[model samples]
Target chain A: MRTEAIDPPGISWHRVSPKYVTVRLVQWAIENLITVVVLTLPLVFVLLGWWRWPPLWLAITVPAVTLVLAVWRLLLIPRQVRAIGYAERDDDLLVRGGIFFQRTMTVPYGRMQYVDIGVGPVERGLGLCTLKLHTASPGTNASIPGLPAAEGARLREQLAARGEARLAGL
Target chain B: MTANVPEAGAPSAVPVAPDGEWLRVHPASPFVRGWVALAAIGFFFGRDFFERLLQGRPVFEQDFAGRAPWLVAGGGIVLVVTVLGFILTWYFTKYQISEGYVRVNSGFLFRQQRQARLDRVQAIDIVQPLLARIFGLAELKFEVADAGESAVKLAYLRMDVARQLRATILARAAGMVPDPARPQEAAPEAPEHPVLSVPPSRLIGSLLLSEQSFFVVVGGIASVILSAVTENRGFFFYLIPAVLGLAASYWGSFNKGYNFTAAISPDGIRLRYGLLDTQAQTLPPGRVQALKVAQSPLWRIFGWYRIQVNVAGYGAAGSNGETASRTTLLPVGKLPEVMSMLALVLPDPGTPEPGRIFAAGLSGLDSDGGFVTTPLRARFLAPLGWRRNGFATTDSALLIRSGRWWRELVVVPHQRTQSMALHQGPLARRFRVADLVLHTTAGPVSPRLTQAGLDEARSLFDAQSARARLARKRQISEQWLATVVPAPVVAPVVTPVVVPTQTPLPQQSPQQEGPQRG
Candidate 1:
């Protein structure tokens, strides 16, 4: 991995690094499973005659719709995986992502309350980790997922140290 | 099901091993089986047997062969399920204290683990469910202020353990000597400082006077009558249960209200109460952010007032474990106690005199409570009615206002006040009234002092604004002195150099410094 520190003197804004693709993919998988299950379950029930079996044409139509959706999801996954990024500027850490409705969030390091490094079973299986940043302000928490465990720990330490320094200054 | 454990070389706080005998006394656990058994009997044998008898079906007829096996199978399933539930309930329920936190680990397939820090705990309430009270056991519910969750429950702790734990946590948090270990010689005279208990008469009086209780009783009766008419049931069966429930609830309310006394010690204010499961909460005064005293029109006849405070970590009523009660330090509404409590908890806002002076100047109302302003500006809204209002102040400023419709009372600290603005709407202009908005860095503290007299309002706004600006300027100078001056001799020498920049420094200083350093 290559690390670069860019300080464009005139620009005050922060941007996240583009290497957060793994995080986006992990999140997408969790969210997509629910959608897939909800779409597929009715067809299974109909075929098994659990309640009342649907007409043959209706059964065929539902499966066809689900198949098309699955194909569409497969094609869009890579582009979404590529868009994730995070960056830290002088005053704030920025997290940027989303393909359709782009979102860029800035959290001032001075206001950070704590940092957490977590790994779930799927992420651990994939050799990935997550970093959750919390602040005193409610409803303004950000999580960066899909980094290597060592990298996640290092980033958490650096961010926590920076937060302590800023709080001491105030 | 075991997964890979992380390498144990990391320097982190060691997880304390839990201590004490693994014991539980859940009230519902033992009797819950009995209810299930009764339900099964009712669902199967009783219902089928009664229905068959009513329809004149024989016990050992030709159709009995097919039905008997199905009945036997169903009974076996019910028995197995009940026994399994009882086993799971017994195995999964346990709580223990380890180090400075209480750890509760439970659930069967989906496990839940919770740890609460003793120090962060605000209050602990023990709830005795209707069934639980019969068994002489209670559920200990902990209210932790900064715990990132609502409340945690330890099911079926012996009432003694729950009380001991509450006292232990409170003593440790407040840094007080444990009451249990106090010398025996001092115990006898301790009763001299009598516990302030509300008499039975007073408790009933308070409940009857409460608008909340009145609403409950009226609503309950209305619902019972409507249900009886709609369902076409005999009034006896339906109304009896409703009446009984209400009576029980009313008694519970009275019992909780009976011992409500807020006593102020040097440490904090302690409030103690409860009928089935008693609770005591101690809150330090400094933690309170804002205080409000409110009264409805009905309560105003009896000079009753309800006081509420915004304390950090104190959640709204139902969201936390506290049900049907406000997050109130004082439950009983009284005027004299409210005044004394305010004086004890909050800093002296200097006296009622400042508020009187400010109110008089803004209202143009005489000491006899008569309006001295012209009819166009000052029109009386109410002649006889309950007024919702109060006065507030910081150390350096005061404010007072009273109105039913467009009500406000704002006080901003002199140094903290940022800017003042005069706002005029079309209706206000017709009445020669203007609203003065005072802005503070913290937030806006605006009081529409009087709407009728535009001239007087504007003049007062100007006078207040000037005083605010002067105070702000003095504060800034003092801050500058604190930041800039250090050593005795170095201060005078460096003061002149800093003074130039304090006024306005050109951008050239940065450019000059870059070349000089190189």
Candidate 2:
């Protein structure tokens, strides 16, 4: 609720909407399910005698391993969502994420090429949007996922205007 | 200088290019494209067709003897259609350089018009493909800012005209008068003075000496042996295709860099290279975003270094949308050559004592170079390179020195830095060391100061963040011809035997203030 810009920058980190956890969980489930479906479809066809031989062990192992991985990923969805946090700095935007290999990226306002706000069908249903920020460097893959729609729009506008102003000043 | 720029749409005379005439490419332009198709056809069937005649077999009567006359007519019709297609393509393609924009109109059925604003022109390249080169023709590629996938390309101009057009367009872009003394049909002469050529012997030696070539040769030998052991006579045939493919690529790379020479023109650094197909690329000052001086492990034995750069829109798009060879500053050089190249590419490696820092960057660390090296604990992470993995900063850039056996020096100008990050892996966190990643545009120079003490990394994170911010704020235009006063030349540490590429001597101007001591 507090909108104060903290001193000793990046001290206070803003977390994405809590509902994002559920959104991510669903997305993860869908992705995993797709893998499971792709893996199992061939197995089903093979077992039904509709397809040619694929070695019995491969048919069984591929689906089984993929199902286990899908379940494992589903369990980690919450932690993955929790790891993401961003801070709006005076001259740059900082986004930090990743559970194992933790990464912290600072995208300067002046260097920003463009910013896009996207609301997918599921994200829209959840009143969430992803904020993607781009710079001239193609290496910059900085994006904030699961932001509330209003906050996402406001941030996009602010970043876009700041990007233009900074570019003009340069 | 700014006052002379004609306003958009006003057409108030800038006689840089001939006024308002849509110039068609050389009449032979269509043949260039047609020959490419012909080459493809010949490559697939020429051998078979020849073999039939050589063996005293009927050339065209094997299957079509009953209908030979009709088949011959159909083949002729097909050839005619292909020729017609190429001619139509050439007919539709026309480019006109006006006061404010370079407009290219092409495509026969689906008409397309692409214009690149002269002001927004970043760099111009004159590329000569093998066939085009054989015909003494070149293609002009114009890189415009924010024109994704649609960079205006005008192809198949007479080589002489291509170079002249490049010079004229560059002049207009730099807001300077086009050089009027240029001879109309003058042969392509190497620019006067201070041209650096990568000798063919050294080029071939360097290519063969590469680790990539080692793996390729080793793999080829291994496959050959394996096939021999397997008693498969067909395996030898496999080597034919494999070797042919590898030879083609190797030859392509060689040709791309054959007779490689870098010279200075009024435009900027002009590079001409290629054995079969020659190319001329002009990179004006301030266009290079970042630089990397790398020594492959095998190359280190010979004390050779390769310097590459990231110039937006200039390099060829590599796989994964990355830019490849287009940014090669010096593919292979010794320390002296490397240093000379660094002088041209960065001009100010951000340090007053560029030579000392550059030497330290290429080789191992000196006792008293201003570089901040990794702590003793970092030995576990970079056993051979812990002491050398460090960074130094200058007024306008941060120079990162890394590697031990194969050392690398990455120069990220403060102005060109896109983003900065501090990362720590589990091992790094345990060792109390982190990395400072300074991101520039996708280029060879992804400057990362790995295994720095945590305190140093944090300070770097904060300080570099501030430094990059300030630098971006004061960034100047990429087109520097109008504003550039000849920079004062600094004395080189080791005098290179050959003439160095004439670089725009950008002195420490009053505006680019010293990096504030935090």
Query: Would you estimate the TM-scores of all the predictions?
Result: 0.46, 0.80
**Which digits, one per residue and each the tens of the lDDT, describe model 1 over residues B1-518?**
00111223433421111222233434355453356675765577668778878899884678789888988888777777777766566456555443345656566555566667654555555555545666656666665544234456766655545554554444333332222223111111011121244456656766676666678778768877887778755655656776687677778776666567666543356566666545555554343333444455455565555555544344434433354342565555455665565555553454545434433322323321222233332354323111322223334553544544332234344443333344454555555554444432110123334342556554555455455444434442211222234445323323442223342322112221111100
Stretches off by above 4 angstroms in model 2 are A1-10, A33-76, A168-170, B1-17, B38-76, B145-150, B177-195, B216-240, B314-323, B366-368, B485-518
DockQ value for model 2 = 0.39
Tens-digit per-residue lDDT, B411-468, candidate 2 = 8877778877777777887788878787665555677888888877777778888887
lDDT of each prediction vs. the true structure?
A: 0.49, 0.71
lDDT of 2 at A130: 96
- What lDDT does candidate 1 reach at residue B255? 62
Interface RMSD values for all candidates: 15.9, 4.8
Each model's Cα RMSD: 19.3, 11.2
Computed on C-alphas against the true complex, the DockQ of each candidate is 0.02, 0.39
